[model samples]
Target chain A: MTIRYPNGKLYTPHTSVQKTEKKSKSKDLSFSNRGKTLEDEINEANDYYIKRRLAIIHKKPVPVQIVKVEYPSRSAAVIREAYFRTPSTTDYNGVWNGHYIDFDAKETASKTSFPLKNIHEHQMTHMQQVTEQNGVAFIIVRFSAFERYFIVPYEVLQKAWQAMENGNRKSIPFSTIEEEAYEIPTSYYPRIDYLPIIQQLIVEKCCGFESEEK
Target chain B: MTIRYPNGKLYTPHTSVQKTEKKSKSKDLSFSNRGKTLEDEINEANDYYIKRRLAIIHKKPVPVQIVKVEYPSRSAAVIREAYFRTPSTTDYNGVWNGHYIDFDAKETASKTSFPLKNIHEHQMTHMQQVTEQNGVAFIIVRFSAFERYFIVPYEVLQKAWQAMENGNRKSIPFSTIEEEAYEIPTSYYPRIDYLPIIQQLIVEKCCGFESEEK
Candidate 1:
């Protein structure tokens, strides 16, 4: 089958399908109605939200270090060599109702716990900084086997990160995620609708230190 | 001489330098101090501000379309083929004192007027949307020949854009820019100190429409 990108360019079949088919075939079937991955669903949701003027969120472009370029023509320059950059910030960020929202999306096949390995220390540090700056920050995790999506607020993630640093469990347990995070339901358009949960978080935060202090 | 990147990787001399030198040797020398362009100055300023915790600003990564990737090792991925992706939004954006700031940095050799071609229509539309959302949106224009920098607010740019569509002049005159824009002074560490002018713009904007109404 010929797969075409949004730019109308033909695209090769994704490599992950071949790598994970044996291990994750059932897991993939359980979560995605089509063959769309969690990232693809979130991207679609962002597009829907933007078209409706609901938010101005965008997935940041993947950073790459260009080592060589070939200028075939006056206007056409192609990067002949480059390396994938390790990002310091989250994958997504934007303004929503005058509030800065920053977050990363990750999918784990593990049903028992969401592994800390899915996130980087630098990303957590970035989230902490964003939170300190009065911005909304969180991670959207997908339990692919169970088809569950959760918005784990930075405050909760911070505590977990600190606990890990103190030599506690490296991964947050599934029960803990269920208890602390806001679960988002799947839909046709805006598949992983997360803004309502974000609004709830903002409202709770705005209520001062009463709850946090408790 | 071996060109070293910030990441300490050997970098080929940029092709644009070679091309631009032929067309604009004198123009290039007029603006850049110690081989630093306006963009480099702005980047340095951003780094300075970040270190001071004054603001969180980042230049959006140059988007790229990866056509082929070669994983030489388990951890290292090299992009074998890629194309520089065209961007739809402005170059710089981030949160500043609980405000979402978005803008583009443009340099023009022309001393008489800043050409409309320097700013893309899509970028102007994006700026308009950002302005409507109460986010700070503007353009930083560097007049290379004159060694002048101006922050042209979205309000002025929007009007100019509309006027251009209605058969007005295709560029904003330097005299007009000098009259209507905020001039940002250069400093040692933060070469293009723009946030102070941003704060001023915010203060003026918050005065309940008296000036704008006038």
Candidate 2:
């Protein structure tokens, strides 16, 4: 019978036990990610900044499978069969100047209310851990209608998530968000001028909040 | 022909067409991990520290194959034929106190030099990236001979890795390590007295560093 390896390679299963079909629910990420999903832009900006010693940030690569690889020699290896692997956290994380930066970029269709279901349990759990460690753990909430961005702390997200778990709100109120979050201004060069908000957050939330930019 | 999926599940080949496994000459990890190695201890320790909130650290769970899973219900799924996936980074990362922490732990029977071969290119790349972000990245090098532990920073590791790459040294110089690394004093509570080194790092390295400990 035709079988598949974990890397999505087609294989003929031989003398093995039987199991079920392969149909796992894939996360439905919108392909029309608004002008370079926040991840790509952040990575690019991180690259740009790090080279100049302005700041260092990085988006972790999408995890992948390497099945049926060819080691031409001890030094070189080629992947013959491979597949995409799911990530538990939103991509971007690294250091900004000196602050430990941890965040996820999410897109939402709704104009007024952002859906709590859009964020996964795993990402939330990961964010919680990041925050406990004194990292700048936040989410870049993109409300497409407003064409705006807000840097929402994980603590706020957790409270919002807990509220949802308690069936208090299926969505975080934009008013509450407006009050708590710093509105990120968009720009042409970096696309997301999050550093300004980050500066604000450093001033307000980060320990010994000081502006090194000036 | 009793064909099975990688998950060792039974499958029926499609009648219309067939896809064959793309072949390769590389070694299979499943075969290598068969002997019940102690490689999992670091992963376990990371989990323990994370759960206790003593530190916000974790070993990224190795990815796996889920060719066939039984969903007794829509909410629950049981994996049948899964194999451990390779990881890009060393087994641990998180926040200690208020500092970003990243590390890999390795043990060697060698009395003197720990082989650089234990650290992979991918792991080095991960360390490099973390360092760029100003994160305190390092490795927990364990000399099983005297049962000693040392927290070697990424800078030291990078230099050692380069030397190994240049074939100048097969392993890091023990003297260089003794001079630079913070020897992890053993303890009864956490087993690794990591806080002292962290304290040193904060005083010496982190920008706008704060004394957060009680």
Q: Given the true complex, what DockQ would model 1 score? A: 0.54
Candidate 1 residue-wise lDDT, A1-214, digit = tens: 3535456776442323332323433335445444667677778888887777777778889999999999986677889899988887898888778778889998887768888888998898778767766778899997766767899998888888889989999889999998888888655455678888888778777875334422
Residues A4-92, model 2: lDDT tens digits? 44567764322132211121122225543234555555655666775665654555554555455455665534444455556766566
Q: Kindly list the per-residue Cα lDDT of model 1 for residues B1-214, writing each as its tens digit.
A: 4644456766453323322322433324344243667777788888887777777788888999999999886668889899998787898888777788889998887768888888888898778767766788999987766566899999988888888999999999988898888888754446678999988888788764434422
CAPRI rating of model 2: incorrect
Question: Which RMSD does model 2 reach against the true structure?
Answer: 16.7
Candidate by candidate, in order, the iRMS in Å equals 1.2, 7.0
Decoy 1 TM-score against native: 0.83
Q: What DockQ, on C-alphas, does every prediction get?
A: 0.54, 0.16
- Model 1 residue runs over 4 Å out of place are A1-33, A209-214, B1-32, B73-75, B209-214
